[model samples]
Target: MKKTLLILIFLSCIVMANNLPELGDYSSSKISENEEIFIGRQILFQVNQSDSIIRDIEISDYLDLLGKRLINASTDPAKKIEFFIVNDSSINAFAMLGGVIGVHSGLFLASNTESELASVISHEIAHINQKHISRFLAQQERASYQSTFLMAVALLLARSNPQLASTTMAGASAGSVQGALDFTRENEKEADRVGIQTLNNAGFDVRGARDFFTTLKKANQFSGGAAPAFLQTHPITSNRISDIEDRLKDYPYKQRLGNQTFHYVKGKLKALLGDKSNTKNILEENIKNKIYINEAGERFALAYIYLMDNEFTKSQEQIQWLFDNEQSNPMLSQLYINYLIKTNKVTEAKKLYIQNLNFFPI
Candidate 1:
């Protein structure tokens, strides 16, 4: 599962980077910087120690790059944020005491655009910057730091092991339990305000955040089913919706950067987690009917599906076509190189691999 010892990377980056915010910066006084870092480290330790993290390097790097871009635009660029994807298929994400955020694979599949996903990350980054977790987790008189630490870690484990999460969270008293599960309403609003700015600074379509939330709201109301895991914690109230919409009006709309990278990654992720036959049928039908949000992404998924199915020639066809438009996309390059080797063009594959290795190292 990549098994990169996430904590080590987080610490090393923290040590190397400057301008990191103090724990007391906009946070409660109860938790010191060391204590917040310690809690974040423990949570990351559990994340790497667990077997549920996704093993795909592409997904891992895509998240890392996306997250870092957002972080660079946030209040704390040198915060050394760590990103990980859990294997669970729940449309949720959460932030903890430190600059730690985890995204569920289900969130990726559910998010139609890169901006939509980035909006969530932007919100989580705001939560971390506002020190919401440290303030909320440490301020409770009845809950000690140890108890709060376990509660935070339990949140990371919640997707992988609900029983363990429940048991670990039991250490905190009843009053703290609700705080552990959800942020305060005011905290949610603040996060949205700060996150929207972050999104704007990072050049994402600011409306992407609103679109995702609106879709979730409609889906929940129409289905009469429980809200997605994200909504369950980050409750989208009527006020929250109105506030977000009103906030969006502050910025004039314009053309945002193309989401080609987002589309490519999404296509790859869909191929990684989707049901093979069902996914293939959908992609083909989308192409035939031209009923796709991004035609390039659908074709990218088709190539991935074909390659995984060992249809080398068909995969080659898609790769050649994609080269015309996305010649420099690392994911596409990786797929093309793999296609070359699989089709007994190892010499050409090796040369191409070396040529692009330095540029798209991720």
Candidate 2:
């Protein structure tokens, strides 16, 4: 009986050992808090500096809520995730290893609904939750074991070969930088699986993940060779979409998000990018489609477009609506001042400018 018990115990130990997460896998292990904080700050700096067209508080706040909901479902629910929208007009979103995820403002513009944004956010969140970034960093550290020695040798070589030191530093820095880390094809596949799982658990439409990738594939084809920055880093391939779709097949039921706000935001973004002369054509289509909630954003967009077209009278009519509203944007105030000055409304413009200056400085 004692011998039989020992055999069972040994088998149990073997099973437990097999279950342990291997090195560089996205399991429950954690890096130091200081390291997380350090990386977080760097990501914030990068996000702020990166060029983006939509830097509005309203858009960002909406994203924060969605992000928080998704992150709450993750194993490491405590990790604070920051989301930023890049100004560039590209359908790309990426996560910087240290809990920073950036979605291009163009993504919002392109996305037909909020689920599309959720798809991008969920994928990025998976990258962070799985410690994919840190795992890549650890690998790079191992591969560049001779980096210190190479740096010293390069400095010596720089005397004879001026390019040596610069090249070495560039290579070493690229390896270390969180944003520059490129996942292996295997890691990417794992991220896709986990990302879909996250989207499903968050009650978001997992099919949006598939659809978004399809859109990306189309965009990439159009780009020929010059893919957007997001695509440049987080590559989109045919297999990626197929693989995500396969995983989503297990969850057959589609998730529905009935919020009208997404249409409003997208319509606003369209107006911001579309032509002022054709505003009536575009807005009429939206109205015909019964997109009344988006009317405010479209109006605001037309107003900005008018300012750009130098249509002062039409612009004033648009601004009048903005002024009558309780919510005011300081930047809009500055723009109004410009419109006032341009149209030679000197006295009224001066008063508006002074009020804005006292309340909100440029």
Candidate lDDT (C-alpha), each:
0.75, 0.59
TM-scores, all models, native as reference: 0.85, 0.61
Give the TM-score comparing model 2 with the true structure, all chains together.
Answer: 0.61
Q: Lowest summed lDDT over 10 consecutive residues: which window, candidate 2?
A: 152-161
Output the TM-score of candidate 1.
Answer: 0.85
**Clash count in backbone of candidate 1:** 0
> Which residue pairs come into collision in candidate 2?
52-87, 53-87
User: In model 2, what is the error at residue 91, expressed in angstroms?
Assistant: 1.7
Residue-by-residue lDDT tens digits, candidate 1, 74-159: 98888878888876665778786777898888788778778889999999999999998777656655324444554454454442
Model 2 root-mean-square deviation: 15.3
Off by over 4 Å in 1: 1-29, 142-145, 157-175, 218-224, 325-327, 358-362
Instruction: Compose the digit string of candidate 2's lDDT tens values, residues 228-281.
Output: 544555655668767777787898876485444454456445655545558756
